[model samples]
Target: MNLRVRVVHCACAGGRHWYADIDDADDPQPDDPFWFVDGCATQTQALETACGELLALSDRVVRGDWLPRVLEDA
Candidate 1:
């Protein structure tokens, strides 16, 4: 698969910024991860799986974490 991964900057109201990556598994790796590709199948299949993974991850992020609050609060 030829997948693309991009890092997006997420900013908050207090001017805090965070790193967020949006990746498509079907797209070729934009960098060195190509070595792990393992000659994957068509892009369409890869993209579908990647989308599922991304959605699951987003759910976790919204749940928030205690350590995050401690650091940001300080």
Candidate 2:
């Protein structure tokens, strides 16, 4: 599975913040809960958060504690 993480800056409600997008390139899904991280104060923070989340997910998958839906059929 291919995963991609991107940090973005957003301006809304008279405030600015950073966010992260985590995309499973091999299994793109709309409205996936794992797809977004919000309310970060900086791009570095967003990126770090995304990486941490990805690492946690990876650990779960490796330990067989979690199974990705896309991989269920495999």
Candidate 3:
């Protein structure tokens, strides 16, 4: 199944990033395991990174290769 995902701009002490997460209401934890582009200087760059990550993730999913299994368990 292709899960719906959301990408948002976020910031931390390390700088800004594009953060992606499954858009599942059942699990709305802010710090939950997610995909992100860290230390990005601009939203545009972060977005680009997020898009690349989404493509890569979709590729893996299509190949039946779910990753970072420890995160799944958490």
For TM-score, the strongest prediction is 2
Task: Give the Cα lDDT of each candidate.
Answer: 0.39, 0.72, 0.58
- Residues 1-74 of candidate 1: C-alpha lDDT, one tens digit per residue: 12343433334565533332343355454333221121224444444554555565556556752112212434
lDDT score of model 1? 0.39
What's the lDDT of the predicted structure labeled candidate 3?
Answer: 0.58
Lowest lDDT sum, 10 consecutive residues, model 2, at: 65-74
TM-score of each: 0.37, 0.68, 0.57
Model 2 / residue 71 / CA error / Å: 18
List the candidate 1 regions with Cα displacement exceeding 4 Å: 1-39, 65-74
In model 2, the runs with Cα more than 4 Å from the true position are 27-30, 33-35, 65-74
lDDT of 3 at 31: 55
Q: TM-score winner between 1 and 3, please give it.
A: 3
lDDT of 3 at 12: 75
**Model 2 RMSD vs true structure:** 5.2
